[model samples]
Target chain A: MRVFENWDTSLKIPSMFLLMMSMALIRDQYLISLLPCVAAILFIASGLPLSLLLSRFRAPIVFLLFVSVFLVLFSEGDALVRIGPVVLKSQGAILALNTCVRVLSVITVGIVMIYTTPLSGLSGKLKRMLIPHILVDIGIMTGRYIMVIGEDYNKMKTARKLRGYMPGKSMARRFGVIVPTAATLLIKGFQQSERVFNAMRMRGYGSSAAGEARSYALERPSISSFLMFLATVTVSVLLIVLEVTVETA
Target chain B: MHIPDGMLPGEICAAGYAGTAALTWLCIKKARSSTEDPARIVSRASVMAAAFFVVSWVHIPLPPVSVHPVLAGLMGILLGWISFPAILVGLFFQAAMFGHGGFTTLGVNALSMGGAALLAWAVYRLLNRKSGERAILISGFVAGFAGVSLAVIFTGSVLILTIPAHIDAGTEISAILAMAAAHLPLALAEGVFTALVARFLLRVKPDMLL
Candidate 1:
C-alpha cells in the first residue's frame, strides 16, 4: 500500500542507467557482465527468491538463446568449426556470446529495478521527476488493473469451463473463445470504468489533486546517495571508454 | 512484436524511444482536441491497457514461444484516439511484470505494438463508412492483418539497422526475413480474431464502436 517508500529507491534508476550503458558499450565478453552478475546475486541475497527471478526472465532468456543460436549458425566469417557444410563463424560465435551476456546483464538490471522497488514507488518517482500527469496516471492504472483484469480473465475461463466449454483444441482453435473473452473483458472494463469514475468523483479525486498537487513530499536522495550515483555513473562511463578504446586499438 | 533487450544497439533503441515519445505526445494532444473528454479517454485507455496486458499473458503455443491475439483492431475501433497511450501503458506493464520485453527496449516494443494499434484504428476509421456488419468485418480483418504485418516491418527495420553491427550482414538479413515470415501465421490469425471481435462489438455494444 505504501508508495515511494523503498529504501534508497532513488538510486536504483541511476544504477540501472549505468548497468544499461555498460551493457551496450561492452563488445567482447564476461568482464562487463560481471557487474550485473554480481548485482543479480546481491539482489537475490537481499531477498528476491530464485524462482521469482527465473520466472521473470525465463521466456526472454529462452528467446535470446534461440536467436543467438541462429546468429552463430548463419553468420559469415572465418570458420571456427565445421560439421559438414554448416560452418560456425568464430566472429558469429563471439557476437552471440556478446549478445547473450548483454541480454543477461540488462535483464538483471531491469529485474533489480522493477522487483526491488514496487511499481508504486516508480510511479511516485516519475511524478516527482515531472512526468506528465496523464501518463503517470496511466502507468499507475496499468499496475492496478493488470491484476484486476487478470483476475477477471481467470474467473471467466473458470465459468466457461463450468459451463462445459472445452479449452482450446489447437493453436488456431483457441481464437474462437479468446476473441469473445477479450471482447467481454473490454466491455466489462468500460462498464467498470463508469463506476470507478463515479467513485473517484465521490471521493473528491479531481478537485484536491490539482489544488494541492505541487509538493508530493517524497524522500529525496541523500548527499551520500548522490555521491554514490555519481561514482556509479563515472565507473560505467569509464568502462565504456576503456572498452571502446581497446576495441579500436 | 516485442523486441527483447540487447537485440538492437543503444542508439537505435534510443531513436525508437524518441519517436514513440513524440507520437505519444501527439496522440495525447489529438485526444484533447477531439470531441470526447480527455479524462474519459484516460479511464477507457487505462482499462483497455489492462485488457491488453492480460490477453498477452494468455498465449497459445506456436513453437519456440506462444503468440497471443493483439486485439489492436478492437482497441482502435473502440478507443478511437486513445489506443496508442492505452497500448503503451499495457506494454509498460508487460515489461515490468512479466519481463515479456525489456525496459530499455520498451520504446521499440511500444512503437511496434502500440503503433500497430494506432494504425488499426486509423484503418478502421477510414474503412468503416457504412457502419454495417460486413463493413466492420472487412475493416477489422484488414486492420488486424495490417497492424500485425506493419508491426513486423517496424521490428524488422530496427533489427536490420542494428543487428549487422553485431553479426554478419548475411545473418542479419536472414534473421529479419525469418522473423517476417514467422509472423505471417500470427497475422492471419489476428485478422480472423479481430474480425470476430469487431463483429461481436458491433452486434452487442454498438455504442462502443463509435
Candidate 2:
C-alpha cells in the first residue's frame, strides 16, 4: 500500500497523466524505452519491496505478450518466421514489441499514481471540482469495496475448495455454480447498499448540512506541484514532437 | 471480449475513451433526473459495480476455451440506465487491481462493455410485457446474445478502423471476425445462463426482472 507514498498525490497525478500521454504518442521505440526506466527509478526511490513492485507487473507483462502477438501477426512487415505456409512479419513484430513497451510504461505510470497517493486525496480533489457529489461518493465507495468484494470472492473460492469439488467438470456445472454465486454476492451487496443508504439518509446525506454556498474557494495546489505538472507537459510535448519530426525526416 | 492493452491503435483507443465518457455522462444525467433517490442509486451502483468486478475476474470454463462472462445482459437488466457508471467503476477497479486492461485503453473497453449493456437493457425493456417462461427465455436469449454480439462488433469495428489495412487488412479483418465468431459460443452460453438467472429472479423477486 505504501509503495510510492512519499510523493504528493495532487502533484503526481497530472505529471503522470502527461507522461502517459507522451508515451502513447511517441512513435520512436527507443524514446519509449526511457519511460519504464524512469518508472523503475521512481519505484527504487520509494524503497518498497522490489519483489512486490515487480510482481504487480508479472501477470500484465504476460498478458501484454499475448496481446502484442496480435500486432505482430497482423501488421505490415517482412516475414520473420514461418510455420508451414504461415509467415510472421518482422515489421509487425517490432510494432508489437514497441507497443508492448508503451503499454507497460503507461501501466507503470498508473500504478505509480495510485500507489503514491491515498485514494481519499484523489477523491477529495475530485469533490473540489465541479463533479457531482453523488458521483464522487460512488467513486469513493467503489474504491473502498473493491477489496471487500475481492475478499468475498476469496472466501467463496476457499469454501468451494473445502467442499472437495473436483476440477475439470462440465462447463455448465462450473458456471452454473459461478453464475448463482455471483448473483448471490450481488443480492447481498444490494442489501448492504440499502442499509448504508438508509443510514446516510437518516443523517441527511443530500440536504445542505454544511450549506454548499459556505464552502470557500478551492485552495490552489502548491507552486512546486504546478511547476512539476508544467515541466512534465513541456517534456512530454518535446518528446512527441521530437519523435514525430524524426519519423517525418 | 476484453481487448487488452496495445491491441488497438492509440487513436482508436483515444476515441473509445471519448465515446465512453460522453455515454457515461448521458447515463449519469438520465439517472440523476430519474425519480429514484440519488443516494440510493449511488449505493446500488457501487455494489453492482463490485459484483461486476468480481464476475469479470472469475474465469469461467467453456470447454474448448475459458472466457470471462461479459454479463452485459444481466448488468443491463439489473442496473438499467445506471449500468454505464456501474460498468465504468467495475472496469476502473479491474484495471487498477489486475491490470486486466490498460489505463489508455480503458475508454474503449468501457464503451464496448457499457455500450452493450445499455443496448441489452433496451432489448430487455422491449420484451418485458409478456409474462411467462417462453417470454422470459426469449428475453434472456436476446439480451445475452445482443450484449456479447454487439460488443464483438464494436470491438471489431474499432480495431478495423484503427489498424491499417494494406496486406494485413485481410488478416486483421479475419482476426476481428474470428474474435467475434469465438464469442458466438459464449454469447449462446450467456443466453442460457441469463435465462436461468432471470427465471430464478422471477420466482424469487419478480420486481427485479421488471
- Find the candidate with the highest DockQ and give its number: 1
Q: Distance from true position, residue B17, model 2, in Å?
A: 3.0
Give the range of the ten consecutive residues with the poorest summed lDDT in model 2 chain A: A209-218
Q: Write model 2 residue lDDT over B87-186, tens digit each, in one string.
A: 8777777767766766677788889889999999899989977888888878987998899899888877775556443444567678778878977888
- Report the TM-score of the second chain of model 1 against its true counterpart: 0.88
Q: Taking the tens digit of each residue's C-alpha lDDT, what string does model 1 give over A132-207?
A: 6778877787678878988999999899999987645675566666767878887888787776666655675545
Runs with alpha carbons beyond 4 Å of true place in candidate 1: A1-6, A28-45, A119-122, A168-174, A201-213, A217-219, B35-37, B59-66, B164-174
Q: Per-residue lDDT for B108-188 in model 1, tens only? A: 888887788788888888998986889999998999888888888887867666665346566577777888898888888
DockQ of 2: 0.54
Alpha-carbon lDDT, every model: 0.73, 0.72
Worst 10 residues of 1 chain B by lDDT: B56-65
Give candidate 1's error at residue B206 in angstroms.
1.3
Candidate 2 per-residue C-alpha lDDT over A1-249 given as tens digits, one digit per residue, 9 for 90 to 100: 343454455556656766666677766768867767866765665565666657667767775665567766666767899999777888777776776776666666667666666664565565555445666677778877777877888888888889975445787677667766666667667677777789878877778623552352245666666765676678778877887898898
